[model samples]
Target: MKIAASLRAGVMATAVVALATFQPTPVAAQQASPQQTVRVGIHGADIGSLDPHMSAQTIDNVIHAWIYGGLVRFPAGTIDPTRIEPDIAESWTKSPDGLVWTFVLRPGVKFHGGYGEVTADDVVHSLKRAGDPKTSTFASDFASFDKVEAVDPRTVRITLKTPVPSLLGLVTAQRGGYVVSRKADQEAAGQYTAKAIGTGPFQLEEYRSKQFVALVANPDYFRGRPKVDRVVYRFIPANESRDLAFRAGELDLFYGRKEQRWVDRMKATPGLAIEVFGPGELRLINLNTSMKPFDDIRVRRAVAHAINRADFVKFVGADVVSPNPSVVPLGYLGYTDQVERFAYDPEKSKQLLKEAGHPNGITIKVLGSNRSFVEPYQLLQAQLAKAGITMELQLVEHTAWHAQIRQNLSAMVVYTAARFPVADIFLTQFFHSASAPGKPTAVTNFSHCDVADREIDAARIEQDPKRQLELWHAAQQKIVANVCAVPLFDEDQVWGRSTKLEFGHKLEASISFGPMLTEQTVLK
Candidate 1:
């Protein structure tokens, strides 16, 4: 599980050209070819973990979604989360006050490895595990839940401490909402990853370290058996190796590099296509408010004015990314243009710095990862230099960077994420005082911006969608006014696929997981 140190640019460039110029095999030859398996060459050395509640990495999430089933789920074959469809739970009803939610479990759905039928007890256990801070990464999301009870073998009841309008939407999530067999989990002890059991369309067959993860079609899947018999996700650490594999027809699909030049080359390649989609990564610059110079709002504002987001976007690739005006993305319900306040103005930044008693400007040391975060922050350094501010980047390993940032060590933090499905989840996790750097429910709020806490809480229990959006929008305005963060862009994800594979739905911009690869995905 190591990142590739180098990519053979010359070899990959030649491979891309050769693939683009080459002709496809004859239809007769293609028709006779066996296509029962879909092999994907992914850009990763290894996965962190397969435990759905524990792992938060993109690669892990993709694998978990294929092997897990939630009580309720988003639309099949699509990642758009605007609709909620029944999965393990056939139907559900909520009380008028929204305090109680009861779900009727579907019958005849069995967990993998002969664990027995999934019932209300399994659902209750799974949800309780997710709510426990010791076991789940999404404990904060379910903090309002008072208790969960199994009314009967097929009925489960959830009682909340307060009414949450977005409770149903939250339960449909893949991360914390997945239901695991309680018996299987206990018997496996700590070996749950090896004997992963779920009622999904696919079952984990093999997980070879630094090689690949293979899954076979679940014949007893409640929905229906998958069209493809097997799905393989291969780990190719080097970019050139993945490109070479795709060109040689050894791999059916792979994640594309986030560069327009790479995308253009792939698009020209014969028998290959690029899929670009979003509500993508919300790129933002987090300023530690408790830190030295940034303790003053003027300093934060100056830093915000110093950044030219368009310049940063150019380096990341405009074809696959767009500017995001607020913490929330455009496709979501509570998105607003509040971030437009900090338009690129170096003069204003210099003036603000002078007023803040730093006429010569300040040099801030930033701690960031050597991967995606470094390049953008490096570009940001040059941008800030225009206003006489010097940005010194301290390169650290990805895990160390995450750990250090949570300790409030960085002057500014650069992060890119396709966050939760709803605005409340995003707002609460990132801006609430409860989620501040050292709080009990601390997560990603490195900025320690607690001004929007009231508005965020108000939105959580608004009940009316229209009024809820207003509350969320007001919170965004407050964040901007305080200059807690400088949003760079909302990036689109790019993937390369062979012509032989056809996903039943359009490649969806997913926030919960990666591209949809469900029962309907097939090999042509």
Candidate 2:
């Protein structure tokens, strides 16, 4: 059964406007045209501030796409041919030894305040800030860079401590490394949160917490002024409210509201369009290996065998979803379908339980947050019953869930990690033992698998592309074999927009709003 809730209070006026009587309403029609401002409905708030380094959520990343322009930007759709489009840095070259990377900054680009021309100094400062553990910038993935030096006004060189294959992909990330103005950095005295100054196509005009973030087009944008005059991102935490707002015309874009009934309705709607892309984002039940019950591999494997992935997919709509068998989704490079997912077998689960010395029924607490994950937990509760496994479901708010997960308080938790461009990022961030307990690593290896440490270390520095792939595949095989987590379906991101808006599916799960806000979008 599909479920949805409105994240906001009042009814969106836009929906009512459509139902209003047609009485010489040129202003209403004109505002509804493509020329007017585009309102986007997001599931969460503006994150309390617009600081890119503050958090690593998808919302923050989307905001950064406008506030700052990175050296490179991943184009929408497909990672195989791995397109690297120019952003702040137009082009770059790699040294023969692969230790040094030199990037050529785009000339004539200026910061928000009409500050002095952007140069290599800005790039160096940005990298240094990100690498500084004190600053706590989200670009720690590139923290391995030994030093960043300005070779020339337009050229900056990054010297890596070791050869890293995912370097290029890292630079394109929203938090990876964005060139910031030296003047702005010094003026803020290292407290640049809540304020932004960069060379992207949009400039932050105003940010009201829990309400909306307004951005105006950048006249001197290196890529050229964006088509839309102003972009408004409003938080609609409730799926029902967001859907209603979209239908009412209050929002031009909607994302991550995946109720099957809503998708079916939108599919039949004449003016709406749906796009599904590959490299599925895996939603899995993360078992805390540091804790009891899950600490045993046999118990974890039994839990994995008990859950029926096919039924779970069917319960959720499969038109835009699929069961993710491996940590790395299909269609990605080096992703082989060889990982054997444990099929649903009550007898096998019971036998494993007995072998694990659980002669009596096993009771496990399944934790989930919000509606997005509740279905999976509910299904697990029912399925585990067949194997004499007593599963208790706990539904908590998002903030509380984060707190509990960090404390490793739950036996099993439903969670997801956004897809990265390379497999190394996945391996190093999520499975590495060094990042297991205390570090603020995104990998959040909550599964606490100690064996993952050696494999992740090997994969991180494996220079040969083929060797790296082999190492990554081997590491994933180990994780799957141990049943660290039961992989489930990729959540479909659905958007409802006026016929004017146009954007396509992204190979990487990260959403890019720049394409849809282009000037080419016109109203009927």
Candidate 3:
């Protein structure tokens, strides 16, 4: 989500005062007053539900951190390849057979309302709920287990049907696995869609759709209460409007990257700061390989060579978005830089189109949404036109675009996937041949390419880390060589904050709002 840049000075001052008095806490004489409220600006419409099981978008994941707790977490001060840290599960061990895994839970961790202590039952129930097809969770991929048994109050053993080397990494994913309360699950199964109950540091106080969602610190949380008393996430979909709010001081934080103009403006304004991180995500056009025209590798390659990536990055105002050779990005383990990428040549693209039996011309529709992707979509349209490919741009609302893409109704659609700490998650989730085309399942094989079934299968069951990496790299090479999907550029997760908000650089794949928020963040 991108933060808008139109904050006004007077409004910012007023908002700052409100935040200053939000939550009062005792501190040393040298410490400044604790920040009571932190107003966050999000760039999309409110998510329909807060249930971690059902959310698939990045924005939804941001809210999930506040309402839910995972078995493990990517702690602050880590980067690119995130290191796992203990959360609810204090520590865990794997058996020699590689089938049974046991976890030692943190003692005295209680649920909301001072309910019973967190236990093995909660773990079993959460995993079972995630694997259930009716629950709509991506966790089904990792939860296809033989059995989940509670050996004791604080101990749980999970037996897997097959060896999964990346199981822990999967569990750490934002959407995959979260330990939900068994008591709450049974009592609120039907009503849990809108309500959330977890052991995280924050509790959801209120949710106002398309307006804002409020979260208060959980005083009884196993980890101490958050430094900030309350966090208010406001959903502002328009960029210009959001920028206005940021400048006006109606917002304490804005979820956007620094454009040149924004960088200049913020530099001149005191108390406001702009920060830039590496491009850890990719913005690309996914062609439905299951359909015509795209079924031909030459056609796909032609489309890749048609557009100018450099120009697109400049238009988008991002820092370095070059053409990627493979779906697996750089900095990933087993990432091979050996694959060949198509160079920009509109003339060559036209010739390839003619050779592919499109002697006259190829008419195709590019599908996209209007919220955070409008700028990139416009840039793509302009570039594609120069290649002599008659393009029909279909601009739809976010909901409609998601529906159309799932149904495989578009010839091509603009999509972005965040950087996964492990490459297996990206490979198995998105490119696996067996993944169903248009559904809410974790299978991201959106292009509907069926050529890599055997390769993906081989990689999934390979227990040896080095061997699995080799197989995955081989699969990525095959996809790239065929131009199955055209990659545009990597996107950085950007946010704007007050100068007082001090935090370390986030890990490349880090998704948490701000790493410093986890007990480590302190007010200057």
Candidate 4:
């Protein structure tokens, strides 16, 4: 029986209602007996390239957060670009034109494994490397780079072709900004993949793939000695096993399920505490506009109408999930909700499908991650099925799914990501035509979108904040009207931690997508 639009909300609520019945057992006691060693249960089974400039996997990025530092960095537990603090670079100054910028580095900052103290040459080399398309996945972020040169051993200079809203964000301990050891990188002879050696509080000690990566405290670290003696980053992909290990006291911290029920259950556990905050990951289904049936705009609209946004809000719980009325993530610098939105109406969806000459309905194969993402994909499959659209899901390991989707192997892709919290960061990489998959400088344009290229490009160098926001708004309006991708909800980051652990700072926002173990973090 087809699920009518009137009954869609009820059906969606039923999908997650069973999960609420699951209650966690209250622990008799919680212990911090291990002293300083921290064991973390990551959601993935393995790490992707931790080479800073290449990896897109959340697992690798979290690892990068431990072993690397940038000229500037987000304060230990937050992702506020406005509150950036100095790391390698002690201070910086920009010329009147806002094109020429110079950074003065702190002297004697040592690299891991004795590569040598950081120098202007190292900063120059790393920045230049990040700007090179062949060497970095984040090359698109540095498009305005004109040149980077060493002024002296203590200073480096960067010249840009155009002004940006916040240059500090581009060079923070983010995507292409984490500085790698120039000497170590140069001598690795291509063995540098996932072997990150930087000036952070922890240094890589051992790495046994698919098992664990051991990191030891860096006594010579500029940030001071890490409170923990060692950090064991374990790879346990199964949610049940990970949660069991956490509850059994085998792990200090672990990634939790994103559903509200799981969070509430954890909240009820006496020994467990939940860390939920921003930068929230936005989940969206990118329908390949260049592919067969989706190439027809009417079919795209039909797919859009098929999705019931309210159902997702009800399923995830309003507090854990919020409506995304724009193409950009909520709370982003230039986010605007003045755009197109397709209301849920099954009859209109069917009519559109027939109008597009698909009276029998259409079938689409989709690539989905078999990790925490499985739930969302399952929900999506059920929703599409109700609209007479058959969604054949090919669930693969998280890492493989990340790789395959970049190759544009499927007609539909549901991607979850939280980038630098800027409108331009999401716009240029996600919706711009130049960043389309199969292109030389591709980041992620899974839908092969090109509708808003004009506004996206214009917003990059608009200069005025008001005019820039206008450009971004125009871009989102165009993209939504064309149904390039269905903007779903912004679900904040969630992690479960043992109450025995003290992360030093308050558990809040993280751009790394997981709790970062720093020099001050410890087992209470």
| Better by lDDT, candidate 4 or 1 | 4
Instruction: Rank candidates by lDDT, best first.
Output: 4, 1, 3, 2
Output the TM-score of candidate 3.
0.88
lDDT of 2: 0.66
Superior by TM-score: candidate 2 or candidate 3? 3
Per lDDT, the best of the predicted structures is 4
Candidate 3 lDDT by residue in tens digits, 419-508: 445566666666666565744453653666555666667776787778888887788888777676777766655566666554433433
For model 3, the superposed segments whose C-alpha errors exceed 4 Å read 1-35, 77-82, 257-265, 318-323, 438-442, 503-509, 512-516, 522-524
Query: Which candidate order results from sorting by TM-score in descending order?
Result: 1, 4, 3, 2
- Over 1-524, each residue of candidate 1 has an lDDT whose tens digit, in order, gives 01111122212211111111112543343234354777777776887777777777777887888889988887753445567789999999999888999999999999987888998999998999888878788887898999999999999999999887568766774888888989987887867787778888889888888878888889889878888877778788677888877787667778777766677666666667677766577878888888889999999989888888877777777787787778776566677885546888999999999999999989999888865655566678888999878998899977677789888889988887766557787778777788788787886858588899999999888888889889999999898788788888777777777766777766565544356677888876
**How well does candidate 1 score on lDDT at residue 388?**
75
> Which segments of model 4 are wrong by more than 4 Å?
1-35, 193-195
Q: Which stretches of candidate 2 lie over 4 Å from their true place?
A: 1-35, 76-81, 137-140, 189-193, 440-445, 503-524
> How many steric overlaps are in each model, in order?
0, 9, 18, 0
TM-score, cand. 1: 0.91
Worst 10 residues of 3 by lDDT: 21-30
Error of 4 at 108 (Å): 2.7
User: Which residues of candidate 1, in runs, are more than 4 Å off?
Assistant: 1-35, 77-79, 338-340
